[model samples]
Target chain A: MNDEIVLFDYWRSSASYRVRIALESLGLPYRRISVDLLAGEQRAPEHRARNPQGLVPALMIDGQTLTQSLAIIEYLSETRPQARFLPADALGRQRVRTLSCAIAMEIHAVCNTGVINHVLEITGGGEEVRVGWMKKFIGDGLAAVEALLDNPATGTFCHGQAPTMADFCLVPQVYNAERWGVDIADLSRVRRIAETCRALPAFQAARPETVKPA
Target chain B: MNDEIVLFDYWRSSASYRVRIALESLGLPYRRISVDLLAGEQRAPEHRARNPQGLVPALMIDGQTLTQSLAIIEYLSETRPQARFLPADALGRQRVRTLSCAIAMEIHAVCNTGVINHVLEITGGGEEVRVGWMKKFIGDGLAAVEALLDNPATGTFCHGQAPTMADFCLVPQVYNAERWGVDIADLSRVRRIAETCRALPAFQAARPETVKPA
Candidate 1:
């Protein structure tokens, strides 16, 4: 049985970056296929066959293909205990999931390329509007995340002392935040968490600059 | 041990709608607290204290407060197997999560009230633009979901014959598609699955009209 893991991803995509961090963290060797978001390769027939959603970071593992970065991370967490993507306790898991979804669902989803492009088309707005949109949502969203982290459970990472799925999400989102120049100086907890995650070799290797196409 | 469940939600919020369906499906009795999104009550200090994200559908259960609708649903799915919100197998769970995230993260998040309102504000467009935005994203998103349903794994529901978290997400999204008048007549699989789920009392009871405050 051929069980080689393949990740179809875009380097700059927050979702794709998340799964890369997961795979790198888990020490899972996988093939990387860039679905160039720049050229709209994700909408190609070949990519569509890989993912009906026509989104990147579709992970082929365990003889099955998985879409949705969070779901892929959760699958990795469930199957591989080497790195715990989610916490063991229900409440802890819920907290991590909540934090991850805050970024994925609330921030990243809205800032998605398809979405922002539509926003540009509808509003007749240009690059400036795109930057503004990113800053507003990312800034406000991270502020809320900072508030959510105001808990005794929050350790060095988004959850406990060890990193979890929440940190994986946070790093990519923070990258987007920095990319769009969304100020996080006020978001102390988010800044601190991103710094901690970025220092890790797993997150560093998955960086957009690290995998940016030549 | 205060196990009494409480759900802080707005009637029209899609995320809240997903949680409502989950509770109804689980036959889990919960106290409903309305955080009026229209009046901007969700931004109130009290609600923010409960949910730092200031989002609707915050669930209080098993002596802890949980936010993020899908996380709440997943928590319920994990805690209570009587309803089986997710599949038992890993691959099955991945598919269900992917489908659920498609709507929850991809469609619903982008079409959120905050995002839409911001669009309106920035575009200087009126209600017509809002309608256009809703139709465009909801229509395209559902179409992708329809393509995803083409899989053999899709039975009467989004996954197999039994309803999982995907169905919970689908019901609300379909309702939004209908509410926004995004035509789904061409989406046979989605329409059929929605019809099948709608026929079930759990989904019916969670309809926005069913729980809408007078």
Candidate 2:
């Protein structure tokens, strides 16, 4: 019940990567507990005690455990407005949420390990098939996001001059999309935003390469 | 650019159902412009102009277009405080969001029509395979939700006295679950809340049955 912030996370996980960026961006000090998804450690009894959903990026703060990456990032955003994790106006907030959901709800969730593995088992598809499946959805998801980004509202980041929650979702998804061999050559707008976000120290330190287990 | 609220939605789309329930519960007068998903209306150029994501429950209000169901719902929860669409406290809001994301982010997003269709084409699977894929995720998702619902926080609904966004997601998913032949006979907690929400007039009118295309 201590007030110290702690994040249950896996380095390679887009969800975990998201919370890392949010925390790092907010300059919030939090401890990290790695839940190795490939090792099936997220299903551990102790982890289950923290998150009923058995998912990564469960943030513990204010003596309470919070699950779901977007929710956790949102908790950070609402609590730490100095970071401007979300925009100030309602319409701006709505736009940021829309963009965030485009990646979190539409893309990353669909391409989750559990869902892809389920697809593998149901179809008896091999690894190549699975990779192909990931690439197709990742490509389409980014395409939709790219179109949305093709607006005057879109600046160096997903929204305006400053990075927001939408950028937190965007950076990790772009990283993971490339890892899956999805061709992003056509997604000009997305690539520009990804480049902008990755340059910042907060985003750099949270990259999968930096946080990956030794 | 008008102040009138217009929802471009598709009946039988759980995402659309979630928004419909939100609008109905808030007693917001909005016009429905159905985007026939099965008929490929969402891909139409005009619809794409409104929502580059080509997804439904796109709300045009306050002279701006908003996409993503969860985002739209959160806007309603924020701006329409009289309905108490969300909890008052931060911790309470986090838990409510945790439950809401369990369904929106975990289950519904993974089992999206486009993703499922892609699975079918890539795996060379038929309708049975598709149904099986859905039931597995739906069952697991509900099980996770049930565990969350088991805590002392549970009242007559997913949050407390009034139905929140969690129930907004759960009811449509349950309706879709039943439609897809996913048995909920064992998911007692989820079924209980679904029943409670279904009995309400707001949820009743938003049921896919009422909104289904003739």
Candidate 3:
């Protein structure tokens, strides 16, 4: 139990879901501490002290606290080399990192809860406009991901038969898209990969619904 | 030279600046190929062929194309282990990645060129509003980064005395923040790191003004 890991997360956070998937995939044992974003729990003093940014998915590992989903996922990969989440080669690793960043940095950030709220506040746009923006960006991003996955270079997962960091990122983004009523069926390549990932117990267990708050 | 690296970039892109700094720091032989973002050169079929995302800072390495500034930097670090852009240990590596993602995902994307344009179009808000949003997000992000740097763990750079991937991200972001007329000096930690980094020739060569099309 001394090796215990704790994840401070919000169930619906795509970022949190990404880290959850990575932890499950690595089969690491972790305790979950839910921070309710909708209720402003993340902004509370205690949570802010834990993470100065007032963000969820902060991980406590090896007696140190870390924030940011990509950071946490990369840390897990580094500490647990036997369950490497990135490719061993330089180019192969870059491809995986590129895909992950495309979603994490480009797609997810654009549709984030805060951004959506800001857009609504500024434009007086209703849910429709907000959802429209979300759909447009997510669809475009997923198309890019699909293009990469469709490459002959791709196999069972994002990079190859084995799961890499890209797979962890893809599943959560797909889940978020579904919430916005964005149809991903046309993205055959992405759909196939998500289905394959869903069949895995690790990915299954990490679904947002599986978390405590849900 | 056979090992020449050609960077497809734009002068004002924060993402592009990141790769330039990494390449310059590694002391690698590389040439800049400007893709004018303001002129829509990035959307041309020729440029899109290199990066389907039609974004700047695509690295052509040994004939393969690498997109995403973070990905390109990671590739440089992996391929040239001797340069040591990341730390040798797993924990230290995670910290670096976490810091890098904080800026890339949180700050850079929020104030991205495309998003800023979109906000301007929708809100009918002029440069003041747009620049206001940019300063708020970038300033808040730098403050978080400053807190991270305040830890005893920090050295001359973001992580330690040697510049790492986090420094690559920080320099470009600070550049953008300054361009918007944000007073970075208020965030003393970030200012100090930026000052230390600016002293390096690598960072100087990577400045937006140094890129073609300036």
Candidate 4:
């Protein structure tokens, strides 16, 4: 539909999947414009103009382009107030942002495509070393998340029963962890939250495999 | 002073500086506990129990130990509403978080002390290469922040005249940029913000030199 939003993304970008989850949760209609990372399409002049960092999950909203999954999700949540992705209280909101950043900053950045490649090339390490590093970082991060979720503060979701921005970030990071063969079973809290999230049609529809390119 | 909160930090840790800025902006009283990074004091069993990640900027809040600068600042803002470090509205809040992430996730993660050392040891890249990467990454990120701040939406600070959590994160990252000898003058908006932040006693008190070890 002409009214549909356009998401510029790659199939396996955990960041893009975050936005996908948000869009689906809000039940907003959207179209996907695949940018092949393997082909280095993200570095093309046009894409660079959109996102100088040459990253994915850029969204074209109301004729303006927005980069950064957190920003895009925040925009969507703000514009669609009825679909709240954050808590109403300031502390609650910070908890969600803090949890999200734990993954985005500490875990995801370490295991990101560029960083992983850089490590592998520099250390003369094979896939095993890289995978080992990925597992350690993601596993540590998830363990923290598990503790946060196990707190009396946690409900059905990261914050409460409803999925907040934190959940949007968590699911995709877990997806990447799975791809790396990291065991999620040990992370009982994260596993429970992920399962609850996957059960939701919104989260299901936004999965990497559900996207057109896959 | 007995009732003063304690902040466990490293003099050079950008994450710790972020909390310092927030505390300064909010005019909160706290004592600093220095953990020497070069001395490997952060890995000490005592410190590890306070923070499993062995990271700095852990806050002792309301009898609970809190790690992560974003989380500490948010908790501070929440507990001290009058010192509101984030915007009241979701859109404004999202913009702040987005800017913060640009520094925390994109810039800080890439140039982290750990990553830089890894690059040196693994890539056999001399200090020149390591420092080059740091400058390039931080410089580019500051430029992005400059663009975000240039919008008429920006007031005296990153978000507005009154410093928010975003400004707290921005100032220290700028400090790190300066340490790298990057010509911050080129990024006018960032220079302006850093100048504005430094003028405040809160920020000054939170400077690395102001910490106990220094």
The clash count for each model shown is 0, 0, 0, 0
Q: Can you write out model 1's per-residue Cα lDDT over B1-214, one digit (the tens) per residue?
A: 8878999999898889889999998888989999999999999999998999888988889888899998898888877868698888888898999999999988999998999999999988899999999999999999999999999999989999899999999988999999989999999999999999999998888888999999
Clashing pairs in 3: none
Query: lDDT, candidate 3, residue B133?
Result: 83
Q: Tell me the deviation in Å of residue A170 in model 2.
A: 0.5
Q: Write the per-residue lDDT of candidate 4 for residues A177-205, one digit (tens) a residue.
A: 89888887888878888889999999999
In the range A141-180, model 3's lDDT, one tens digit per residue, is 8887776675666889989889888999999998988989
What digit string (tens of lDDT, one per residue) describes model 3 on residues B32-91? 888878888987989877887778888888779889999888888887866788998888
Q: Rank the candidates by DockQ, best first.
A: 1, 2, 3, 4
Q: Give the TM-score of candidate 3.
A: 0.96
Order of candidate numbers by lDDT, starting with the best: 1, 2, 3, 4
Residue range A1-214, candidate 1, lDDT tens digits: 4799999999899999999999999889999998989899999999999998899989888888889999999988888879788988988898999999999999999989999899889878799998999999999898889999999999999999999999999999988888899889888888998998999999999999999989
Query: What are the lDDT scores of the predictions, listed in order?
Result: 0.91, 0.87, 0.85, 0.80
Tens-digit lDDT string for candidate 2 (A1-214): 5879988999899989988998898888989888989998888889888888888978888878888888887787777766688888877888898999999988898988888888778777789977887788888999999999988889889999999999999999999888889999999989989998999999998999998889
Ranking by TM-score: 1, 2, 3, 4
| TM-score on alpha carbons, each prediction | 0.98, 0.97, 0.96, 0.86
Error of 2 at B185 (Å): 2.0
Q: Score the docking of each candidate (DockQ).
A: 0.86, 0.81, 0.77, 0.44
Fnat, 2 decimals, each candidate: 0.83, 0.80, 0.80, 0.45
Q: Is candidate 1 or candidate 4 better by TM-score?
A: 1
Candidate 2 residue-wise lDDT, B1-214, digit = tens:
5779999998888999999999999888999999989898988999999999888878898778888988888888778766676788777787788898899989999888887888788778898878888899898898898898988888899988888888999998888788888878888889999998999999988888897768
Name the best candidate (by TM-score). Answer: 1
- Candidate 4, residue A53: the lDDT equals 65
